[model samples]
Target chain A: MKQFTVHTGTGVPLRRGNVDTDQIIPVRFLTHSSRTGHADALFADWRDDPSFVLNRPEHRGATILVAGTEFGTGSSREYAVWALQDYGFRCVIAPRFGDIFRENALMNGLLALVLPAAVVERLWDLVEDDPRVPITVDLERLRVRCAGVDEPFSLDEEIRARLLSGLDPVMETLGHHEEISDYERRRRPTLPTTTALLDGPLPA
Target chain B: MGSTLAQKIWEAHRVRRGGADDDLIYIDLHLIHEVNSPQAFAGLQARGLTVRRPDLTIATEDHNTPTIAVDRLIQDPAARRQTELLRENCARHGIPLFRLGDPRQGIVHVIGPELGLTRPGMTIVCCDSHTTTQGAFGSLALGIGTSQVEHVLATQTLVMRRMKDMSVTVTGELAEGVTAKDLVLALIAQIGTAGGQGHVVEYRGPAIRALSMESRMTLCNMTIEAGSRAGIVAPDDTTFAYMKDRPHMPQGAAWDGEVAYWRTLRSDDDATFDRETVIDGSRLTPYVSWGTNPGQSVPIEGSVPSPADFADPQERAAAEEALTYMDLKPGTPMRDISVDTVFLGSCTNSRIEDLRAAAEVLDGRRIADGVHMIIVPGSAEVRRQAVAEELDRVFTAAGADFRAAAGCSMCAALNEDRLRPGQRAASTSNRNFEGRQGKGSRTHLVSPAVAAATAVAGRLTAPSDL
Candidate 1:
């Protein structure tokens, strides 16, 4: 996990809605066992088109991605966010995001910012006009600042805490292992136990 | 206040209620497969953690296994290593695995309910996104990432955020030749793909109750395409009857006790939902997709939608893009679209009933010229049953390939079974996303009956056409 605060960098535009996880990183590239270095896999399908913004040399090092509404709309593959982060992007601005993708992005320290459709359009227009203009996404203040325009954004309190503190959810949830075990014990007498199922203690 | 069934399940499984945000819910069942389980086990090993409940954890080799030559060795080395890794990891963690040659081995979602591991009023989690398919048993099933999989494996607990409730009530009986697949596809087209985001859709009504257990599974299976993590139907007499005498189901007095508890898992009469929608099942026809996404669909009798049909500019652009990619004209009738292949296996529609439905259409008839059709059973049990019923012979005699090896063959394109570039297919799978079946492969999602009929016609057709 990586701590996320305020990130300032040049932005690029992906002016397409419903950019699904399949387009982010197709299943063909998922064969590797390691999690890192997926940046080369980002948007493999679209990168072949020379006109695609990410293929341009000017947008090579952009850290902010301005996409259309409903970005990351298919599959719960966490690799989508991993690919984006490995490509040097820190935040994605969209009108809406898929629920599972949003959760995966937050857990992986890739900030997904939801802004109004009008604000997102403005950001895209600004970035397209001046490809080198730096956009500052301040998570501390819940605002996105670019080209003299500052817009407010909000995140769920729990997700905010995790991003700011670099919290590992698996570690945080393990603290309640005792309670989970206690519940399992209580369920043993009443519910169907896996032991009974495997050993034929419960009749067929 | 009265509570919905989802609320009731949440309250029962909640170990602790966190402030204003989320709750810690105890998981009853955790299923894993080869593609998603290896990295999770790696995470566990890194932390020096053992599986909290080995008995509750289940693994199967499905996504990466070949659909032919079950007795022969796996040809793909990378896929073979993944299966080997899963076997090694499960053995190392003391977890039971249904290996490739095992009779119980199949798709994780299929085998879970088939083995009676999925029960009413439980919380299930898996690393694969289609884990929501288990909600057919009236459980709150969810798909999690690798990190969450590691979390569940270590602690058997998940920190879950509460989702809004949406009730979809279907009234009226389904017309003949209209299957659950059609019903669900119609709903997705109406609501679009993102309709169920941040909500748990509860399917209820006369039509839903009339479906068989397998039909219910079909309805629940594709709910993920609607962007929902969970979709459920309260347990009823139909559910109880389906669970009776299963190998893992409780027996004697325990059975009666479980049924009594399951009966109380329904939503209260006065319960309210955050949103509500209604569908008249009697009017729906066989549906098929014309474009890349699942939501880009039309009824068999309708024509491809023009961009002018869309009110949203983004939607209009997407329609244009889909047309260009699909190489389809806006005015072309859906039934006029021909296919090069017909696929008949996926988590959505590979059960015994689905096979029988396709067999009925293929019985005593040859597939159209230049068309290749393949039928893969849902599991070894389904294959055995189909063989006993002579459905395999029916498919083979009809000039179709009857494959016995079971897994997600063309659905994920992770194995030897895949569509070649520039191929067109009428498939019984859920997704038709760009290159889902294979790169440059065009897919039109259809029901098993429709898929079989399309095989016989070399074009999209409903069973009525037969």
Candidate 2:
């Protein structure tokens, strides 16, 4: 996995609460076996409309996605995170995020930042007014800062660790292969000797 | 500090805490499927490692298998390769498998409970998201990745951070025509899909207690929609009774001892949760999704909301986008939305009970002229039971297409069966994600009763409309 600091890019101000994984990357795209190439698949249907933020050229290379509350709601598909990352989004600022999506995103090195609703609204308005405005998401400090915001918001500690380390449950398990092997060997029972069975047979 | 059910389960299974952000917890059961297993097995092969606990792991094919002719599966070369790879992988590792032709073969979630493999207080992991459906049996079931699948096969454990607790209490009796599907849909709409995120939800109260095993499964199956790791219903007499005499259930004295343990699974009277939501079942009506997402739903009697009416600008934008994709006019009665197709089967609502509910509605009537209706059972056993009761005949007589059993047929379009582009379908599936059924296919999540009624009316309709 590649590691890079999150910096705000050109912004697209989307004011939609309860944006779900289905809307992020529809189920039709899920059938593909390859995990890559989902950037184009992000909001495929919605991007067709000229009014969508991503479709507008002014929001190009936006690494920060400013949105309403409860972003990334619905299915636990990690592809949604992949799509967002591939689409040049490094961090998502919302009032709240769906639990599984947040986990999946952070585990895969995507930053999902949750801030107060008022702060999110302010960021959305700033971006909507001028799509050229940029925000900076400092991974080291775990803070998201924009021009209009009074104070940078801190991300959850758990999410910060996941994003910085790129550690997933599977990678964590794989890291301890030796310890697990030792435990399995020590706990396993030995088979009885053939001599012991022969002695019992002779007695019988 | 207060602990959520996820935290409790995670802590209980902890083997060790590795560095910051690395908490290793033991896993009890590892369920495998065709789509995600091949690569994991290849990883194991490259490492020159073997499956450590063959007995604790199980494999089955669900995603790519066709519903028709059991013997003709090799027709699709790509699907054939996936199935062949799974067989080869399991064989090389000495792991047991339930292949397509096997009587035990079915949707992984369905087979787990039916075979008594899903038990109380056990941690279950699979590569499929809906694996949370197994939580209905009181297990800490959730989805994992292929690398995690290999890890569980090799180590029998996983690592994770803890979660918060959430209690959803449903008091009062459900009115007639309200089902578990309706309850879950209503819950998703009220809480807005992300409500239960980072929380382990425990369903409680009089209404939950009144639900049958099938109904309970339906309720738990959609927990993923709420972004929860799992949804659990405490094991009660009803739970024990449901498991009694099953082929793999404990017998006699063992059964008694198990029941004693299960009795302690419920929350104590003084137990508290981080979050609590109460719903009066009496007020809930038959529910359906009006937009692309499960949370964008309303009661059958309600009309689509005008985007301008939304207080939140974001919400208004979402409504506008949803209306555009759904080809629905804002402020119109949701009941007026016409449907060209009706599908009544999925892990969410494809049990025998669900089939019977639809069959009862379609028994003496024919499907509307332009409506194309289909019924796909959840599993082979369900299909066998339906056939025994002649439910298939009922569906066929009503102009419905009755297909063989397959995973995510119309519910997910993982197989050959799918809606054509721009077509609208009323589905009993859990999610209504845009094109969830096919490219440009529109889905409206509904109860089995509503799906049946819609088939007859060629439009979105409630069971009462039948």
Query: lDDT tens digits, residues B282-395, model 2?
Result: 899999898878878889888988888778676678788889888888778878989998988878988889999899888899999999888877777778888999999999
Interface RMSD in Å per candidate, to 1 decimal? Answer: 2.7, 9.5
- Supply the DockQ value of model 1: 0.47
**How far is each candidate from the true structure, as Cα RMSD in Å?**
1.7, 5.8
For B1-466, candidate 1 gives per-residue lDDT tens digits of 8999999999998987775778989988889888766777888888888998887898887887887857756677767777888889888877778777777778888888887888999999987778888888899998887777888899888888889899989999999999999999999999988888888889999999999989988998888888886889999988888888667677899899899889999999999999898999989999999988888988999999999999999899989888887889999989899999999998899999999999999988999999999888777777878898989889999999888688888998888788888899999998887778887789999999999999999999998987
- Compared with the true structure, the alpha-carbon lDDT of candidate 2 equals 0.76
lDDT of 2 at B316: 77
TM-score of 1: 0.97
Residues A115-178 of candidate 2 have per-residue lDDT tens digits of 8988877888888787777777778866667785755666556556656666544555667878
Instruction: List candidate 2 segments past 4 Å from native.
Output: A4-15, A47-52, A59-62, A125-134, A148-151, A155-204, B1-8, B17-23, B36-52, B72-88, B145-154
Looking at model 2, what is the TM-score of chain A?
0.80
Question: Which candidate leads the pack in DockQ?
Answer: 1
